[model samples]
Target: MYPDYAKKPRNVRLGLCTNDFAPHGQYGRTYSCWPIIITPYNLPPSMCMSSKYMFLTMVIPGLSNPKHLIDVYLEPLIEELLQLWHHGRKACYFDWHRQFLPEHHPYRRNKKAFTKNRIENKVARPRLTGNQPLDRVANISLAVEMPLSLPDGYSSDHKWTKKTIFWDLSYWSTLLIQHNLDVMHIEKNVFDSIFNTIMDIKGKIKDNMNAHRNLKIIWNRPELELDERRPNIMPKVVYTLVKEQKRRVCEWIRGLKFPDGYASNLPRCVDMTELRMHGMKSHDWHVFMQKLIQIAFREMLPEHVWSALTKVSLLLQRICSTTVDVHKFHELENSVSIIMCNLEKIFPPAFIDSIEHLIVHLSYEARVGGPV
Candidate 1:
């Protein structure tokens, strides 16, 4: 059996993260710097995330993002990583996150929630024990480098962008988690979709005329089928609030208060004139969704709609907790699966896109890779 190298003493498990950001206080400039950061996950959670522990390995001076070409500049760092590949194991990155969830979870039994009529009954195959993945990749030709001589079904059935330079490291395949999900960005997206749809904001709402028509064709709902009476008008659905309800929700938010340093001035972001929220950063949305979302809109929306939103808020709350209970991750996973299934049944198709679906994986990620 393979030992968990990441937990071994004196092991330096490096996390490589890079993104382009506009320099603070230079608001006038349109340019941004692409900076790569290295953090030692070997440190305790309290110290690992601190600025004191983060090391800036390299910075690409940029007026524009180098995109994939950033890899070209990272050659030196890649070489160093190859040399320091201390664990010396070989493996493959698993794509499925749901494999970490309990096998008997009801999320896998629902037909309508995910795909059409088909339930998720198959358990995800476990990762191959040893040299299998390396052998498999050796047969996969990189299409970017050699386009003409690609093997059969390269583009259609299985897509291989390129075996990344990181895979060259001796210990790379030993990691349980290859990439961490950006929880904040995903949280903001879910918040935006739900809030905008319920507010019935013109351009932002997903429960528009088109989605209504699509739903009518797909499912049997007597109340929603009333659009046949007034073909020109998009009949109002229960998910969206009436104008008065929208106004009341906005007014409540406009005067809302929170303890100092608990969250930002959320009241400033609510625009009574437009009846929509604005200027909210990702953190602000995170705080609002996990804490104030269900409470603020409690009586304004229908019982079912409000209940679904509250469940989502609770899921976010538990996942983002300061302390993660490793034993309860299975319970968390089961809850998330059911919550997502309920939301899928309630929200419109556009509202249930990738960001919303990403909720199903958050628990699994936390189980394998703790809080991030």
Candidate 2:
């Protein structure tokens, strides 16, 4: 439960906000409402007394830093709090940074330096003469001139400032303490990157051939044998078969009926001729790779290729479940670790690190009921 001041109707105002384009062909629309009174008092007795928290205050669109829209959203709320009987000077920004950098890391150290300079020289510095509240908020604007010098391998170039209204020192009492990492997004991204690597998509290292050869050697069964007697297929022929297979698969997917209780949103069927692998979510990718691929193109693909795909698919399928036991998650981690170690070329060290990081957290999250 929040403080008594937070529950006060006079001290709070709430609205659900969204941006939408005009029906014709216009863009850049703005809409706001302060009419909705969404305090706990308006809710039913049972709902109001529920443990779950809800704060439907103000919403600001766009990702720009110095747009003044965020300031507009918070300014009135701050004023109301200030006017309240139990006004508190202390405020905190809860920053969820997915690409987490540790305290000792150079990037984090650089951010700390930037934060310190902004706080001491700008935010905390006394103003000469102006509206005190406006001046206080203006001090919160952090300059983005300083470029982050990262380690050699990092791909990003210094193009934009990292300043946000959330980092405004004047509004928040504690700067560093407020910033935290969202483990869910981090895990999602890590899983996506790993999946991309295995599929050899999105510029990831393509060692599918090596994986195929390794799989052939490991699974030296007669059923998984390469037909040496058959003549080599032409490149054009292979391409045509692949294209046709994709079209058929797309048709099948559209016709397929999902059973009740499927957790993920049903993937929309797209015309493969018009859109090549468009409208697919992360879960769709997993499903396609794990179940659809082999079923759709069973006879067309080579034994080695099929075997390699199956191996990766099975491994990923085991770990990518919506609900995984702690023991299963641990087993998945160990299995992935072994695979990464055994097939260095197929699963590059950097790619493997992403998988490992997510796997390490998966068990903890499972124990806690869900991802954070």
Candidate 3:
């Protein structure tokens, strides 16, 4: 409908536009920009649509920041819209980003006060000081205007300057909406953290042996067994692979190939040498959680733990579905909340806090049918 809308003389009104940075690999060294354009709900049902139709207008690779995003990607898009408006073909004028500002003219002048506050504290943290608004673009723009020192490692040349594009109040006042939080990235991180906590994998504080012992106890319970048969062997302690085991596991992962007609987002595993040269991707981690762990550990992981892991995997899978709606997302959130409640004893508050923050936003995004 964008082409058709561009041809129409009526004012164009976009629903919401979301933006986020995505890492190219498991390591966070390199990132890419992703911007999505969503159609307004008021439009005909045929026009407002799915992720497939969501306009992904740019893919700026390397590294970027909010300012870079506004200047490089967003500003160009806005310029095109303004052109359409000037030519009497108004493509969109929703200005979702402006909804969050106070109901007053000349709100941009509030930057001076925030700058003064920053000057006084020297090391004071920066925060949004504007009135509550639906989109945070205004607040973030204001925050950028303050004379906060750049963080270490940022080149002085890259610091904000008087000529920065986002400083143009007229341009910012017409912003489409606040950038979205990438749900996939958030879910993947939360899932990894939860899985690592349970397995007592690298970076988690839990003791692997203790985790194994708890699982063993859970699996060995009298009520859990089938009649007259001893439970299958469970690991008494977490397995630490010797050099030979490491080589074998690496070999197996490298040898893996998807069968014909199997569709996967990630490609088949590369050799260890290639993996070392090129870092792992999020899909590699997904494969690790969904398949590799079971093969590597065999019967070491108890059935109950696998059941719990399955639940987490399924939740991630369900939310990514094109047919997922607000109710389904709410169900996912409730299911995760229950999982967290039951596992609270096993996981730390800090770990649980992180996951809760991501889960809590699902309902809002679901209702809006896009990232909020």
Candidate 4:
């Protein structure tokens, strides 16, 4: 690695990002395409993120994410980078573009990318910024699937997965801000969990038989524990909305209107009959979490529950603002922990996902890494 690379602004400083997206809506046949994009940090802020300048390095196509096996496809990219660093910079060492294509999809079969002639069956499966939930999840094997909380004997103890392929880059560890949490995405995940659980959307919310059974295993809230006499019936919880409340919340969102271009037509996202919101975009989630959340739930939930949710929303608004207040930032850094604990008491344990706990660390990152 060149020591002067940082001093020389012309040197390419790469930022790589990828996420699973369905080009043709979420329903019907399932399709996911992970677009691997690269951007040079040397460009001006205006052009840094411009699609014209960004490069689509690779596209991993399949029914689900590669998960741990992603490194196999990235080997070429790694070799190219290694050559550039160790053997001096040079472009176009190898022509391995087709390696990025999908080998076999759930809908159709195709030649394997790496082993060309070999036919392989489809492989399965599918962050917030800021903080780590030390007691993250129960012991789980990552190869099978993503870390899942066990309904029985669930433990918050931290469990880590294998190191990422990016670590193969020699200079990666030396970077001051090695990785930053994607705050916008974290906001959406948190909102989805909270909003869905509160509205009690079937199959979407975290509170269920698993969560109810989990209470008995953890031995925390005796009140929420499933009664031996009525194991089939779940006890009512404070965080959820009744049938009427869910109907009203959905109706309110359906009828509300916003100024042109200020936000999307959120009315369409609401399902009147189902009493739930669907198809909300990232920015729409941002608006709802940072602004509309408190007002929408003001009457639906209990005062204490509403107050806790409001604090969570307010924390996001403050953190996402154009500027961060030193005084408020410190207060936020300290206060998020208490708020998280309050939420733990109110919502089911299953509700405490990684993103939900990430609020505890946002203030720390904001202070250290500058404004988000």
Candidate 5:
């Protein structure tokens, strides 16, 4: 890693002691001496008793010119095929051909730019008579070619630029070398079950909110009740995911299910004005928030889930509703909102306000939408 890319390994290790000429009465034998430079493969003199001569294997530059690299790496597979063919096993050869042949092989004709060998030089080129460094002109050229120079819109974000370069590199690499890593094969069964479940729900559920809300039901509902046409590779795995989804969905849905214009903790259907006058006196809003949260977690929630959520509300209030300082609160708000939105779809309109208002005040400093 420490070696410079420009330095050739052989030149660095051994230098020419003499040029093509020798003095009179002397044999012109140019001796090459090894330097004290030590690599991982190099052994020290103390480690071995015998004097040794080191030979460096030269890596021809064009061998890694993308095309040759692919051939060298796949040499084992080619050797196996040659051995099979030499044995006069025509059927084995045919099977090997069918097995290893790629459907979209790019090697039939080397038309791609990557297959062609080209010199990549890091040397400086004369562009203009200038006092400025080479980088300045390069930057100016880059800016001139940018999309913003035209009338059409230009995205100047660095992230998009990096993504485009990465994708192009990946495409070229895939063409040169088939990435044989079976990514989907590793998780194929689970992936297939999830994919099938999503396809099943895609058209059947009318609303996206409903589909999102019923993610658990879509996966975990007893196999006996699921549509037979829908394929499920692992019902048990699907069932486990469904249960987890249900719990998460229910948390957010609770807030949106709260009733509107219903007097909170009020006695005997009192008038709005009377309830407001008395409600503020008796109810501590923070305490009331605690009770509502506790009611949702009737069976006592873990410190991480419940306490983490409550602390988020406090942080949100303390930070004046800015998400930068309260990333966790933002996460909690989003998670809770998904559940609440789903619950709102099924809940009666009259019952949504009280619960929704409480969650809103906890997560955000903004006042409730309507009058107090």
Candidate 6:
């Protein structure tokens, strides 16, 4: 939002307006010759909002010790977020860069003890932070929502990134492993759940877009053509776009599939659809599985491991951006299994041995529960 090419003063203004700063309580009566005397009316509402928001949002929460908020609130927020979203969590001053508030931006080289710039930014979700560093500013773009819980036996398969890798290793490894396995067992069923959920969401979004498109199209439709029922729905423009998107998704799923020697070779998108025909279970989630997996690998795996990861990442990136194609199934499966094996190598021998044990434990547990 801040204009970049301007002179220092203008840049500062742009940054200040964007940064969170509270309204001045009441300016000093003194008039200084060196500094330009500016009145309160001259200040933007955003600046005032920024300051008050920071004080209320950051300071009041931790009056005991500055670190208390960081430890109790910020730390937990980060940890919980890492668990929930699989991304690194960091907090910074809302607007330290322009006026130089202390620790305004976590990525900054120098930070102060008292200034306010506290914000939690996800390392993986860089867009969420945007160009300006501010806290609690109203944002309408890119709002994310995630399901918090899934069916009794299902779990989210989101990946945790490097930023949270250490945290995950310390606290989430066991729970995450169990969840991952549970998810894999019911993977086919979950696809149906995902597809239906996405379809519903897309349906709504498509409805709105279609409505708007129809209004515009009707307004411009030639007078003679207007009487022909206005075509009930907007012209196929929006529908075509929606179709293209769904087609891409289906193609992506199909592309990722590989041929198996046996009938149950591997679960294709079709299998996922079949499972969906029946009731499917799921959880609410903010993170997409593709991004989550990338974050997890980046956080958990070493550089050497990335060589293999890069290959799969490229495939996944394509799948995420475009759609699924079953024809690519063999490549996808083999690539993923290899990557999984490589990741298995990253853990300590004990961890690996424990996984072996866990496999047995899970098998027994699965049997007790019913089928795998």
- What's the lDDT for all of these models? 0.72, 0.40, 0.44, 0.68, 0.29, 0.30
Q: Model 6, stretches more than 4 Å misplaced?
A: 1-181, 184-194, 197-332, 335-372
Model 3 regions lying over 4 Å from their true place:
1-141, 148-177, 191-255, 259-278, 286-299, 348-356, 370-372
Tens digits of per-residue lDDT for model 3, 75-133:
55565555445544212211111222233423223332121111121221232322223
**Candidate 2 ranges with C-alpha deviation above 4 Å:** 1-241, 260-268, 281-283, 286-294, 320-326, 340-372
Off by over 4 Å in 1: 1-155
lDDT of 6 by residue, 100-130 (tens): 2123443332222111232323321222222
Model 5 over residues 1-372: C-alpha lDDT tens digits? 635522322222221111122234344434222222112233344532223433322222221133434455344444433443343211111001111113333322222211122221222222222223232223332333443222211122211211122222434433322222221222222222222232223322122222223223322223223234544432232212243443443443333333554324333212222111122222323323333333433343434334433542343334333324455555544444433333232221221333233342333222111111
List, residue by residue over 70-101, the lDDT tens digit for candidate 2.
55656655554444434332221111111232
lDDT of candidate 6 at residue 80, scale 0 to 100: 41
TM-score, candidate number 5: 0.17
Pairs of colliding residues, candidate 3: 12-91, 12-92, 19-180, 100-133, 100-134
Instruction: State in Å the error of residue 203, model 4.
Output: 0.3
By lDDT, the best candidate is 1
Clashes of 5: 11
Root-mean-square deviation of every model:
15.9, 21.6, 23.1, 21.9, 31.9, 23.1
Lowest summed lDDT across 10 adjacent residues in model 5 is found at: 90-99
In model 4, pairs of residues that clash are 129-181, 135-156, 136-156
Q: Select the stronger candidate by TM-score from 4 and 6.
A: 4
10 residues in a row with least lDDT, candidate 2: 90-99
Cα error, residue 340 of model 5, in Å, equals: 2.2
In candidate 6, residue 96 scores what lDDT? 19
Query: Which is superior by TM-score, 4 or 5?
Result: 4
- Winner on TM-score between 3 and 5 is 3
TM-score of each: 0.65, 0.33, 0.38, 0.56, 0.17, 0.18
